[model samples]
Target: MNVFRLFEERVAGALGRLADAGDIPAGLAIGRVVVEPPRDPSHGDLATNAAMVLAKDAKTNPRALADKIAADLRGDERVAKVDVAGPGFINLTLAPGVFLDVLRAAVAAGADFGRGGVDGPKVNVEYVSANPTGPMHVGHGRGAVFGDALANLLVFAGRDVTREYYINDAGAQVDVLARSAFLRYREALGEDVEIPEGLYPGDYLKPVGQALLATHGPGLLEQKEEAWLPVVRDFAIDAMMDMIRADLAALDIRHDVFFSERALSRGETDHIAATIADLRARDLVYDGRLPPPKGQAVEDWEDREQTLFRATNFGDDVDRPLLKSDGSYTYFAADIAYHRSKFERGCPEMIDVWGADHGGYVKRMQAAVRAVTEGRGELDVKLCQLVRLLRAGEPVKMSKRAGDFVTLREVVDEVGRDAVRFMMLYRKNDATLDFDLAKVVEQSKDNPVFYVQYAHARCASIFRQASEAFPGEPFGPQALLAADLARLSDEAEVEILRKIAAFPRLVEGSAHAHEPHRLAFYLYDLASSFHHLWNKGKDQPHLRFVNQTERESTLARLALVHAVRCVIAAGLSVLGVTAPDEMR
Candidate 1:
């Protein structure tokens, strides 16, 4: 159950009563009103700013409005105490039994406890659009994991989410890939070949060469450059994309769509031209000459005339070029068309998870979306910062398969997928992360993934102990729900209950903010509390989960343990990490 949302409705109902009594206006826009845990836990269980936020519109002082709201909330049997704090903030202390009731709800809901109502607005999250030039690097893996977790969080929070990947197969990079594969193809035919500069040097292309040989039977070797380039380029792209998909599957990530950049222009319908023409009709595109970039000698630069988009009018630093001097569409031009296609396909809300180098490109693309969609579109760009791959604090930088950087598959193979996914999202997406190979695999409280997964595993051990403690009698939901939970009055037990109660509210906030790391932090805190309480049971037998003499109390504690497992499993699932039932 969403206890915070429940209280928010109660607050709104109180304001409605005030309106009926002619004390305030009918509706004062309670959209900003929220119920959350107090910053200092000693203050109260729940707090709200409803009175303070609505004071000005209600034509009353915050203190006066807070008193009226407090009077109405104190009438709720759920709220044990309501105290008006500084600046008219209201802190509520819920009844003791209410928390136990929530535990029952969590047990009933199981892994879906904190899940939000479904069929909310559709949101498109596009990420990990790494070029199909090589095996994914650690930096690319970071973006993939971040985007996947963000999409999962959105789905948990009830948004209809679409996971998307953009293929960069239309660029000069693919031509280089074709030439590199041809080198391997010749080598496969027993010719001595050296990978020259400006082409890929990785041995990963060897398999592509073998596949080409098996298909073409040495026929393309006789053709000239023009004929063989297309044949090899398409073949290499398909192979590289297949390899990329397998790498992502190793981390349990799958996109609903993989949009091709080449289809924007090469298909029967040239969408790039249509997008540009649609904007040109609105006077948003024009032929103009751009000033020479700063810091270059004046004679060395040329102010060539080009087709440009009016990005400056929509808040970009300057108008952006849409076409190169060679009359080919620029990369930015193709990106605009790709995003416009998203809008036309009924996804006007878009989120792109890009690398740190793309930071400067965010505003211009956002501006393009506005120009093409006429303000119906909204774009949110979250840049995933560089991942510094380290082995015990030493930089580990080269991969033979990728030729330049350490491959993502190598790290996952070394540490497994759960460690990689958790460490990738353990920090904020925009902040640079140092992924230490040595630390994440440690089975200790210092390792966050291990700590969280162990919490679920520990809960399993408790159930095992209970199964032995209550040999013949059943301890299923019916029996556990019948237990006298009033015996669970320990301070540490109540603290864990507080964390469980705050989960649904946390999911809503993290989803709305598009920040999945918040769930990571919350899970760590919950695990810390659970581990602390588990250690407490070691010294004090009364605080232990199972008691052969106290059957009802043991069942009550099992219900609590099971509820924590439910929440942890649900949180880990949203993060694209596994909650192991046992940690070896």
Candidate 2:
């Protein structure tokens, strides 16, 4: 089904055959050989770097090697022409029937046309584990969208994926949230409560307070602070998690697991203590006096020896504290236990999608996973860079201190979940995204979501138009797939067929790179081709879909349309975006 992979295999086979016949050198490495679309379409259907990549290794001139490889490949039934271009690059143009067959396969497969091989190992994708103290913001949205898309891509690529979120309810921030909600609850009870400076001041917590007052009435207020803190803390944490679940549901994201950090060590289960003991057995933990942290030094820095993990043994910058001087396990210690849980869950391959602000944490976390899994498991950390809010061309300051921070819900409400998800993934995860509230909602090509969605809509319009034009003619997938595709020989029609033929290659490439943004880019290119063909029909009467005089031409064009629609649906499904039949 992957034409590019097939082509590469055939080319490599030819090279191996030549070597066996003493036409070429033996024992040449072929793993690095790659075949891809030429930068300029006019160059050929596909380009291979086999000659250039193998020349130095084989002790031969690149051009001479390319000529030999080209001569060997010319005999392939699928390869109609082979030419050696500049710098020993070999461009191969396949027979038009090859592309036609690919389009037919796409029509036959429907939305499953481009589903590629999956990784055999299980992958745990942990994302959007933002602190449960407040609502998710635009930054969290990026991580959520990126992580969800990655999980989808991996599953499509053949990995057993477990989408998970690590709850931060056990952190100091949630304790602050508890105090903040207590203040609001007192205020809701008709008391004059002064909001503390370091507590949450958002109006969103007022409901949590009111709910608290309704549940406990005046009895919670009568209780001393020590007795009520834990009660309110758990209540506020639960409410915050409820809000987060709703927010994620709004975006169509669902997690397979919600790991509670508090559950790791509570009630004598004591997995954190067990994990630390296991590390100690391996000589990875010790009570050591550590050097001061760089940048901002802690004024309360103690010279006393503290329990520390030898994180440097696994490539962290320095040994890290497992338990602080306050007799509580540090966040890193809990993280180790959490990752240990993933390994226990049989996740041999893992990916953590974190915000860019947590960039410094990646090395330590990866190091921990390595140590815990004894290098048996691999961890890939994808850090999403910050998104800058913009209105038109100007930067929109979003300072929470000034009470102007943009929440994820606000962005989703304004531009809608589809636009928000698509835009969030429209760029590389490590690259900064400029999310403009006004521009993304604009119905133009500049807005990629609209352009791609419009392509799907246009294909639907073709089907609808066909239903009116050819009422008795069959327009189902099977009918179009059985259409006379040989009639689709026009130069422009062939171009569209060629683009559709590249969908499998695109999927394989993007999945291999672990980059979903590549899918967005490829979708844009495919949509451009669809749009251009549509515009071409406006100028050339013969290119129109409703060629009343030629039934074969109409059927051929309909086949192409179905193929486009199938690819769009497949791509959107991978991105978790709905392909609307009509854009209302």
lDDT of each: 0.92, 0.88
The best candidate by lDDT is 1
Which 10-residue window in model 2 sums to the lowest lDDT?
A: 396-405
lDDT of 2 at 411: 77
- Model 2 C-alpha lDDT per residue in residues 126-245, reported as the tens digit of each score: 999989988888899999999999888877776788999999878889889999999989889988877768998887888999999999987998898899999999999999999999
What candidate 2 gets wrong by more than 4 Å, as runs, is 24-28, 56-61, 294-301, 394-404
- Residue 303 CA displacement from its true place in model 1, Å: 1.5
Enumerate residue pairs that collide in model 2.
117-157, 118-157, 118-158, 119-158
- Expressed as tens digits, the lDDT of each residue in 1-118 for candidate 1 is 8898889999999999999999999978999999998888888999999988999999999999999999999999999999999989999999998898898888788888989754
* Number of the top-ranking candidate, with TM-score as the measure: 1
Model 2 residue 277 lDDT? Answer: 98
Task: In angstroms, give how far residue 568 of model 2 lies from its true place.
Answer: 0.9
